[model samples]
Target: MELSAGKFLCLFALLSVVSAEIFFEDRFDDEWEKRWVKSDWKKDGDGAGDWNHTAGKWFGDENDKGIQTYPDYRFFAISAQFPEFSNKDKSLVFQFSVKHEQKLDCGGGYMKLLSGDVDQKKFGAETPYSIMFGPDICGYSTKKVHAILTRNGKNHLIKKEVPCETDQLTHLYTFIIRPDATYSILIDNVEKQSGSLYNDWDLLPPKTIKDPDAKKPEDWDEKEYIPDPDDKKPEGYDDIPKEIPDTDTKKPEDWDDEEDGEWTPPTIPNPEYKGAWKQKKIKNPNYKGKWKAPMIDNPDFSDDPDLYVFPNLKYVGIELWQVKSGTLFDNVLITDDAEYAKKVAEETWGKHKDAEKAAFDEAEKKKEEEEKANEKNDIDDIDDDDDDADDTDAEDSHEKDDDNNKIEEEATSTHDEL
Candidate 1:
């Protein structure tokens, strides 16, 4: 059955929107506590693994909802499983925000995308994942945005080194893998790096390789220089010594041959000395360019334009170790629409970043004032204790005078009766 031209066009557009729709999203609201499972798998064997809610110091709204990681020897491996989906020919968009309020030292702030079946409760470093993307900071040496893809049981790391934000502020990380095997990494919606998967990762054997049967000709000359037969070594070159006694030298006056050891002059570099003589080198007339291997189609290589595709994606996880916590993760989204992901970031982080910064500043200022006030009060308390001790001494001196007055009053009453 054939449809009318107008109806066929409408059908195509409708399917496009459906396919590009947001397949998975978690704003990490209050209800997210139930949806996300905190894995008992801790790497350090010291735990209390958990995720805290914050309005985000960057946003300053606890109700907006983001999970905060705690500090000090924690290995948090938590996962949230969703309905299975695949990249297909559509673009895959993954976006999320991370904030390190505690000024993290060395830790991992990455998230993972898993395929097929997964045990959410038991997810750990050993568990398989399809993709792992985010910033990882371990000292100054390793501050990079990791974009790793799992292909054929091996993890393919991004060839290009991408820098990440290390300040105690919020930053958005976006990874977009297109159907054409090209990918882009974005920081706060700005593209930082973009390239092809085949070039950036060793996903498959090279498309072309050096032909094993091809070899350089026997007469091929790679040398840039050749020995000059006309040039000869100078006569008596070996007669000159590399070092000789100073000609103006004289023994110290303190030296005595019988009772003391004789003094010898220090050797100086000989002026007549020349380096070991050799024939001079002239440019090689038969010099050819450096030999290059001839490239041929690799027999084991096959083209897969959609190497970035991952069929049956079922879960997303945040499994990492932290030395200092206070990392907030929020606004997770997976979709085929790049514009949609950008809009979400603008609405959430872009809109409130400045205000949140101001709020953080205000809080810090207030804390400083309170500490000063407490210090002043501590000094005042000591002064008050000293004043109380002086008052007690004055009361003790008055006690004897009061007892003598009472006896004098009783004696005066008996004199009036006499």
Candidate 2:
């Protein structure tokens, strides 16, 4: 009962797809309100901003909608729960697409993966998370992806500078952590950073450290160069003055020696004078290399086989404070397969990225045209004001001429009468 090669390959593909488990996914469709819960942590203080369900002001597809943060200078907190799962000996992947349509000046576009059931109504910056991954933008100083992982009640941030997309366009961010403790960060399906969790985070003590007992020997000559004793100072070096009187100077014709001080020529810098003298340097014959304590195995370091595991992950959330909100989050996914996540990104962000960019460019061009039109209108207004001022000046001149003619007529009548 042997199967054909084509049939075997198809069966294999089906089995592969089945093995990749998706713990949670959200396209933020019409039923998104049912799936998501908004926090009321700042509602009473009038600091909580609302979330708008739309594709944004400029988007490729109206149907391809997501949840967006609304208004400026407010806090936003929202969460969605899924069945509990663990990534003890498996790969864990978190991915989503975000678009900072407001050209986010200072805000976070990152998402969080919660380990347990969290109070969705009070979910804010204080809520603990197992992993936080995505872009965090704040002017020119901070424009990098934040990859933070929580272990043993402590959250550890990745020690790598991973740059993110700063444009006002949709970008897919993917974070994958493997059982082997290696992690990778992808922006728009392209790998931007990858390293071991042990190296990137302070999850565990370092494997090696400098030997504590090792110290520099007392007689060790660590200096590479020494002053040359054979190099001597030139004769009459100190006698050469730093300044010399200018020989071209002549006495002034109107010099008052009694009233003013005696005339002295101004001094100029001496070209022949060397400011200071010092001995030259030469390589030391007994020079030893720079001293460093030898490295040895750290006694406190103990490797954990499950450093990358995040057990009981049951929720995904977004908690942020945006000074200018317009960050749209969509296509959130948590899975055990990298390929499946990549495929999802491709079908969503990849398919519409170019169209979105084109739409954004068109909007920017329209805005520029409007600004130029406003500038032209302002100039026209200024010119109109100047023309009115000139007209008033002409009227005033006419009034003055009439007054002068009346005075002249009065004066001529008086002279004729006299």
Candidate 1 has which clashing residue pairs, if any?
55-61, 55-62, 71-325
lDDT of 2: 0.92
Report residue 311 deviation for candidate 2 (angstroms). Answer: 1.0
Write candidate 1's Cα lDDT for 1-418 as tens digits.
Answer: 9999999988876666555678788888778878888887863556746777876554656567789887567788888878899899789999998888888889988999999998887899999999999999998799999999999889989999999999877889999999888989999889999999989999999999999999999889999999998888778889999999986989878789777776778899998988788789999999997998899999999988668889989999999888887888988998898877887889887876787788778877888999999999988998898788778867876776777777788778788778
List per-candidate RMSD values in Å: 10.9, 2.9
TM-score of each: 0.77, 0.90
Cα lDDT of model 2 by residue, 1-418, tens digit: 9999999988887787788999999999999999999999799979999999999988888899999998899999999999999998899999999999998999999999998878889998899899999999998899999999888889898999999999899999999999988989999899999999988899998999999999899988998999998999989998999999998988898999988879999999999988998889999998988999999999999988988888799999999899999999999999999988987888899988888889889999999999999999999999999999999999999999999999999999999999
Q: Tell me the spans in candidate 1 whose CA falls farther than 4 Å from its real position.
A: 1-20, 43-48, 56-58, 243-268, 361-418
TM-score of model 1 vs. true structure: 0.77
